[model samples]
Target: MPTVWVLGAGQLGAMLKQAAYPLALNVEPVEPDSEHLPNIAADDIVTVEREQWPDTPVTRHLSSQAGFINADIFGRIADRFHQKSMLDDLAISTAPWRVVNTDSTAQEMHAELGAHVLLKRREGGYDGKGQHWLHKDDGGAIPADWLGTGIAEQKIPFDEELSLVGARDKDGNKVFYPLTLNLHVNGILMASISPLSRVAHLQSQAEAMLGKIMDSTGYVGVMAMECFRVGDALMVNELAPRVHNSGHWTQAGACVSQFEMHLRAVSGLPLKAPDVRGQSVMINVIGVERNIGWLKIPATQCYWYGKDVRPGRKLGHINLNHPQKSVVQTALSELHTLLPQNYDQVFAWVKQELERA
Candidate 1:
């Protein structure tokens, strides 16, 4: 088997490495900034954990390699400006938006988009960083530096935020997991649940939207699409070109994990829709020390990233799943005392979702 090389040795890369072990595949997760580059054979496949990365010697080398997966698709989707444009060109629904430049004015933005606007950096920004909210009441001017470096979008109201994680292979075969209901607190994902019984009606629509993107780009590997549930319709919020945080629950819930699916797709392995089992909840362990108490709960699994903990940093994630909804609920209830008070809202949201008849 050819080696699989992953750029950006973060948690995603680590998980990918773990996934490859069971398949007897060699996977290397390289630090993006490291000056030394890996020896690339003609059959070795290259992929990225991050949508955007700084241009460095190692990155330059891997990007130029013939075996790189989705190398041409990353740059186009990395910039929010081009991403939104592509969505528009495809007739996909997204919030009204425009590129912010030197001559752009707040009045014009409000008039065109709405009284409320969100400015996102065109380049790198994730986990809710590099964003500015402008409201009519605040009465502020768009920062001069943000011009030409950001995309301004109307702050449209939506019933809920959801995400779809799908994978497409070299043969153009595609498979998608069920739509996942997500909860974001201050722009950071706090929790997510999948195989939702209530939103079953929207699954195919979500898949169609994401399938259009992957098919258009000839994208190969796992891709995540974040969306806004507006009434009976869905609007695209952002696109992740690689495995996404929202899909982490697949580690314990699906027949094939997202990490494994990504590896399979990029390596010319057979691809098919994974058999989803029962209910799955993923609680992001942000900025918290790992606690052994989490293991005490039944049907609960923890994946600690082994990274230094800081305020707002993604330390790890906890996955809970069971064939019975009642069992999953009971386990979630058990986690209340084990985790910090910060997770109170997350559990509360989960409770509401479980009770959704």
Candidate 2:
């Protein structure tokens, strides 16, 4: 049995645990504050969330048998400026971007890019938090206490955002999952459409990009890239050094799920090419409750995370599938009808929609 120690017992780790079981990969998750770790190889140690492990004393305990992965490259690979720098070094075209360190720097950056910008910390920020939009005349309200260092970049006006998920094995062999078209609601991901129409073109770009990123970090395992489409150009938006939210549609939509791919990559196994059959639309369950009669649409399968539900929380997600592209649109339309409508809308947009629907 090949035993691997995974840091972070969070949702990603838990899901990876589930996926690895069927593959006979022994995965042990050691919480950041855990006092004990089962006997695991040092080179075998991987991280479900790499950014959280750095600066923690537990890293000292990562025995020689274990090797940290999704490594401490968060600061090096996750930031927009760093990513752009890497892109420039590799001669890739991305949205024109600049990094701002202070309010004065913001002005110079604004002049270089635009009035509006996307501001985020250099380190950790996810689920639509730790990021703020900067307008032309706003006072500097950016919190100084963001997780670690902070960065800012020009927000590109693009038609849509695309995300790609892929993995590199111990031997540097890489395999990519199908490209996915993403939809976001209020900065949080709401839906994902997989095996996007332009998979080949996007796949080539993503593989080259990931290869460069992984080479820079000496990283092994899953990495995802978010890209923005403006006219005919694909501009890289951001990179996640792990399996991503947009790729979750693969669970029931493909022969090789991303979690299993991460497992294969980190544990030195053969990478399986994604075999996408039917069209899939993955809808996120956010700010939603089971008591709301969360509609179980036909051709849909639910994946509920064992997490405490909260306002704006991602409790779980559902992947609604159908054989042809026609059913996909129908499934989405059906799900839209099933969601609850607010009655507090007598003077609101719902009242207008009520007359239209």
Candidate 3:
């Protein structure tokens, strides 16, 4: 079996292993302290997470370079300024956006996006972390890292948030998984349902936008296009250039999960698009609360990372699948009851989601 190398010891890498294994693919995981990446053949694998760049010479040589970036590189991808500029030129609609320094003044935003703004640490923000919301005149003190890691956007009054987890191969071939309708509870992803509540037009639009992005960046791998849908208009929220939290529902919902697709994309193989053959509800287990009852749900697929927990920490996620559409909501509601509601409201240090608008 060809080895598929994934870097990181996080939840994303764990799920990638499960998906790649069944396809007779060898999934190789590299933890942060791992220094033996040379043991594996370079051609056999791709990365799982794209957040931090590795310090190892062997791994660094295998990952992204100027000519092309591999299937990883979510927020971790380089040449970000150029990529962001390209995204803007696509004339692809986006939420209110601006780049600021640690002490740069805030600009007036469009009224329609929302009466709030969301700040992201252009480097490591995901699953509702590394974000702060500004409502009214309450923009938090800008951190110095925001100079290099700063990308800010208007908070949108989206009817809902959705993500498209898809792939593009080196030959520019493309494949897409279903758009997952995401629901967030206090910035942390609460649940994601496959077979979106919206129509084909929206999914197609999202696919087209993502295709343009891949074409522009010359990116190859699994990517997810996250956006805000305000009424009928879909606006870009941000781009995650790897398998995303929203796509976690695909573990049980689709014919092939995103991890398998990532391997295929990096290996110069034909990419297989995934269809949501069944309704899937992926619920998260966040913070200090362990929802042991989640395992009791019928047809539930649970993955618990053996990580020590704290408030607002992402510990595990459960994917509940059903061929019948009826059980999706019931399963989600029940599992959600077991998870902790946002503890941010209780803590003074927990950043509020809505501030400077």
Candidate 4:
């Protein structure tokens, strides 16, 4: 069997390594800037945890290999300009948007998109970084650096946010978990819940949209699509060409976790839909001190990334699952008490969502 070499050894890579152990498959998480290079044996597979990589000899050599999966797709998807263009070419729904050229004026952007516009760097930004909001009332000006490198989009008035995490194998076989409902706190993912009976009606629509993308691009392995729900329709927000944080619930909630599914896809293993046993919720442990008490709640599992704690950093995540929604709800209540006081509003929001579910 070919060893899977993952670029960018962050939490996602760590989890991939963990998921590989049970399958008796060799998986390596290599640091992006390491001077050392793994032997790229003819059959060894290459994949990325994050979308982009620095231009280095190591990256160039690895990405140039025959075994690198979805190599051609990454660049197109990584650049927001190309990504939005592809979506438009496919006639997929997304926010109205246009490229911001160096000579472009804020007046034209506002006139074209809307009074409220969002400018995002074409490449490299996460957790609300590298973004600027231009409000018509404020006479919003585009940062000089952002000009020619950003894409301006109409500020969407979304009712809720949702995501679909799915995988496609080399033969184009695809499998998807149920759509997940997500909440972002200040542009960072805070919580995710999956297999909601309330939103069940949207599953097929979500699958069809994502399937079209993978099919068109011949994309293999795990891909995630984030969207905004306006009434019964979904507008594409962004796409991740790797496993996503929203799918973290699958680790404890599904029979086949996303990590395993990615491995299976890239390794040429069989594909099948994962069995989701019950309602599941994933709470991101951000900027908070570690607490062993988090495990005290029933049906709860915690994963710590072993990173030094810092404000606004994702240190770990906790997942809860149960056959009955009430059981999951009770566990969440217990978890709330065990968490810091800062979690009060988060819990309140999640619990309220549970009642609605």
Candidate 5:
């Protein structure tokens, strides 16, 4: 059996593990901060999260000794600074941004980019962490701790947040899933609507942009690109070099899930068509107990990560799939009525999307 060593035992890793079973692949997951490393064989496939790439010997060995093994480039374009620079260099439309080094001051950046600016840590920032929003009315002082490497971005007034999850293989073949409309609560993704109809006109453009990025970076495996839809134009937000939260709906909605697609790409298996039969709405279960009762709902699939509940943590997700948009909308409405507080943001977004549909 083909054995793959996954470098992070988080939710993504666990999902990948589940997705690998049908392919008869053994997925060995190792915690990112584990004190000891696993024994590796020459034939073992090494897959890593972007943050853990620097510490994986298997990835290092495979990358350095080119002829020995094929390794996915995890960290190259995962860094926000690198992603921004690359997109800009390629003439891709993204929010106007400026890198802030030790010599750069937030006040100066604000002066240049305007009063309303977003300061983001260049290396590690996700789900609204390591981010500082500065407004002219709130005093333009920069935080002392955020003085290191960062980027100052002009916040765009967007109509909706959008994302596309896709994969490319070694032979240059590519497959893109349907565009998704995402809703964020406190900068964390609250819910998503897949195969978005309001923005159907932009799917071609989004896919072409993703294809360009994959070609330029020689990207293999699944990748997600978050974007801001400002009127008719879509501004690139950032890229995640792995299976992403937004694509979780694919598990039940698509013929080939993102987790399975990622494994296939990295394992050199032929890429499968990302065929979608119906619409899907995914809601994140944040800092909550595992509620298996959701499984009882028709057409609902619950994915509960076996992790302790903590504030702002993504404990699990529920994906609702249906062939009819009205059925999906009705279910979503009933879900909202059942748990009004928990599904506040999600229900609102789902309702809006359904109305637009």
Candidate 6:
């Protein structure tokens, strides 16, 4: 079997390990900064997550640099799009935004953007961290921590948030899963419903935008693009250069999971169509440990990441797959009934989507 070395043995890496077995690929997990690279063969294929940029002789030997090893374009695509002109050139719509210096006062940003502005660090922020919301009435004071290079974007009152997970092979072939509807709590993703019923009309546009991004970057492997649905239009929110959270529903609800598709793409295999098996919803298990009670629900599956529990950490997720949307709704209702306090927001969102569906 061909050996594939995966850097960063986190949850995604573990999912990749499980996904790689069916292809007869051996996945060896390695620490990003480990110096024990002497034993690896030259031909071994190495892979890393988007945020992990390892610069070492072994990584260089595997390829000239870290991001270039397999998917050569990620070093540029992993972070938020730095220039508004870039999005315009790609024919993708985004909220009005401007790159601002850290020292720029919120008053100045408010003056330029509006009363409601979101300050985001140019790099390295995820799940609602590294962001500051400024209100016009708050005066000119900028958050001390936001005093660095970042981007200021107008806070959009979007109807909903959607994400698409897709894969591309070396031959330029591409395949994508259906757009997933997402709900966020405190900037962290709390739940995702795949094959969004209300926004089914935007699928083609989403696919076209994703295609443009992958083609423009000569991207290989799986890529995720998040968007905001405003009225009848979809505005690109950002891009994730690897397997994504929204697509986690694929593990139980699709013919081929996103993790497997990513490995197949990077391994130079023909990409498979992302065929949905059923109506599905994936709930993020954040800041809490797993409870067996959750798994007892019909058609529900739980994925627990063996990590230390923290207030905002993603410890695992629960996916519910059913043949009909009504069944999924019932499951959500039962969940809310079981844990009303913890799932109030989740139940409300799921109920709204179910009604819209």
Counted clashes in each candidate structure: 0, 8, 8, 0, 0, 2
lDDT of 4 at 323: 86
What digit string (tens of lDDT, one per residue) describes model 3 on residues 64-123?
Answer: 433234533454343334345567788878865676554554434324334576667656
lDDT of 6 by residue, 95-147 (tens): 88877775687777887899899888777678998788889886657767667
Candidate 1 lDDT tens digits, 1-357: 999999899999999999999888899998989978899999899998998888899989889999999888998999998999999999999999989998888888888888899999998878999999888778888988888889999998899999999999988899999999999998999999998878889988999999999999999999999999998799999999999999999999999999999999999998877999899999999988889999889999999999998999999999999999899999999987888898898999999998892
- Give, for candidate 5, the lowest lDDT window spanning 10 residues: 61-70
**Candidate 4 per-residue C-alpha lDDT over 238-352 given as tens digits, one digit per residue, 9 for 90 to 100:** 9999999999999999999999999999989888889998989999999999999987878999999999999999999999999898999999988898778877878888898
Off by over 4 Å in 1: none
The lDDT, on a scale of 0 to 1, for candidate 4 is 0.93
Q: Ten residues in a row with the worst lDDT in model 6?
A: 61-70
Pairs that clash in candidate 4? none
Q: How well is each residue in 1-357 modelled by candidate 2, as lDDT tens digits?
A: 567677677767777888898889877777877776455554455566555455444555653233666555656675656767887787766767655554435556567768887777665677777787777688454455532356667778898788888888767777777778777766788777776565456667667776776766777888888888777667777788877888888888988888888888887778978788687777777766653343456677777776787877887887877777666566556666555452122113212322332
| Per-model root-mean-square deviation over C-alphas | 0.8, 5.0, 6.0, 0.9, 2.3, 2.4
TM-score of each: 0.99, 0.84, 0.81, 0.99, 0.93, 0.91
Stretches of candidate 4 exceeding 4 Å from the true structure:
none
Global lDDT of model 1: 0.92
Full-model lDDT, candidate 2: 0.69
Ranking by lDDT: 4, 1, 5, 6, 2, 3
lDDT (C-alpha) at residue 193 in model 6: 87
**RMSD of candidate 5 to the true fold?**
2.3
